[model samples]
Target: MTEQQETPPTGVSKALQKDIPQATVARLATYLRVLAVLADEAVAIVSSEELAVAAGVGSAKLRKDLSFLGPNGVRGVGYDVIKLRDRIEDVLGLSEGHRVVLVGAGHLGRALVGYGGFRRRGFAMVGLFDNDPAVIGTSVTGLIVRDVAELTDAVAALEPTIAVITVPDAAAQGVCDLLVAAGLQCVLSFSALALEAPATVEVRRVDLAVEMQLLSFERARNAESAAEEAMSAAAGALLPRVSMTTSKGAVVQP
Candidate 1:
């Protein structure tokens, strides 16, 4: 059994949800993960500084983010790990498991189906689908890949919370439209192409190429900054230093 800990009631006010910055929202997920590890370790209470360090953030920023969820931390004791974790889960809509269906069942789709992280993160993969006749009926990670033609019918039967599209770029928009028509409210697409959907639907793209490009840009910028600093240091070393008198009247070269 884990260590006994005081757990506060878990709930988030609608006002708390309102006007939360996206950056804070993103960091909440990170905090939740850190809290999960702490909870699993049976850690009862976690100080703000400790939790912040574990979550790769500063204590001030972490406290500010938690402020949106209301004051739960004790003055001297810090936060109740389980309670804080539960509250963050509620805020991010992770308290309830999200059922997911992946379309395409290609190489990437198969790889994703095999990944265990999604299931661990409360996302249930209910179905795997593809348009290819040969791909259909094949079992990938225990899920039998169904024909894309059955997508609408499957959506009605399974009632997935999110649809993951891993189809090719050319077919991405069409697949997105089909998912929208089938009444999926949330979509996670890995296609490089941009998809069009109604404002009511939430579409998130995971373009690996674009992410790589961004990393490349940062790498180049860091290299340039390093070079500029090196040049500045070299130039400063070349410049002759002026003699200065100290408060004690001793001469010093600065």
Candidate 2:
């Protein structure tokens, strides 16, 4: 995958005008999602510690992430949920309501369209496309699946902010090229292969297998560490205790 340049969006605050770290940007998304849940539950204010726990991050880390957007929470009262949510939304460009076009109406694509969270999160589903004859012309979650040939035309008409590619690994690059040629500036791909695109176009790949492998590695490492600690404790328990005897002693023990 190509490295993405850290360029701030236009019209952002001076603090945000400077490039935000990619890792921090990812954490901001998590914070935004947590804040959305808080908003739905009618939470007015949440302490930094509470938000950090909810988002699975350290309190200091959460505060530092929010700092990139400038001052957020009141020191005494905690963060105002709605205010913080809006600030994160603005910084992450969610306020713009991005329109999305997804190709590959297979299982993954179908599931993605059926997801209501996308619309709730301000991502509009503009089009769905696939090359399979059986899948074409079918409706998935109110959006008709168009043929791959119609991709460029649909992209032209829909003007999607992002295109999603979930086609098979073999067809992934071809689909990516079509989307790029259709003038799409951003793409989110679920295909296993790393897609090739010009630097001007941003492509993000999500490989489920790689993620699962990472989880497996962490689990194995933790298990190994636990076993080593157990062995160390057992060895300490087996150590002989030191004993002392006095001159006239009937057996003295220490």
Candidate 3:
């Protein structure tokens, strides 16, 4: 009998792998965005520590995260900025363009239509829709705003796979229903209202107020950190100019 050789486990080789976590993949996308910014700044190479800081993660965590995708980095030289960026773009399906339609054409809708981030990230804004006749036929971000009544027709013509709903909470469900009927597979909803859709369609909600609150929390944390640093500086200045050992065995130098 001939001896059989076992195949080595390749990390994240297949799309349907059960081991890789969705959260990790999403973080990888974020890391890719940060890497793009670094590349734009002409950063040639980045250590795991530097990349983690750019991605708002710890070095160890970033290393473990990238390890799941395979050996994508060098030991002493760290990761090549452009190569890692391309690899991540390929992994996140951002290499190909995704067509998107904006519904509502209100403040948030217009902002999203004009958002540079979407364009930079490979999402193409195909069209905009609004119920108001005045806003209809107007151009926002080089795309003509069309009537909501022609939503189905516009979607069919554009073949938009993703729809962004920025309509009023009262009208969100209706807009979502229309989007579903128009054959949209994914929706990035910015409305406050929760919507019910078919099992096949995916909806991601982005609440402005919730985001504002999170930002406020971050500001508070930063303020607290600043206050602590100031107090430490003041305490250091007040102490005698000498090296001292505290009762707790911590060495303090002034």
Ten-residue region with minimum lDDT total, candidate 2: 245-254
Model 1 deviation from native, Cα RMSD in Å: 10.4
Score every model by TM-score: 0.85, 0.85, 0.77
For candidate 3, the TM-score is: 0.77
Q: What digit string (tens of lDDT, one per residue) describes model 1 on residues 1-254?
A: 13233343453434467768888888888888889889989999999999988877778888888988876799879999998988888888888989999999988998888888788778889999999988899899889999999999999999999999999999999999999999999999998877999999999998787767766766676677567668879887544334422222211111
lDDT of each: 0.83, 0.83, 0.79
Residues 135-168 of candidate 2 have per-residue lDDT tens digits of 9989998999999999888888998999999899
Model 1 clash count equals 0
Q: Would you list the clashing residue pairs of candidate 3? A: none
Q: Give stretches of model 2 more than 4 Å off.
A: 1-18, 237-254
Clashes of each: 0, 0, 0
lDDT of 1 at 76: 79
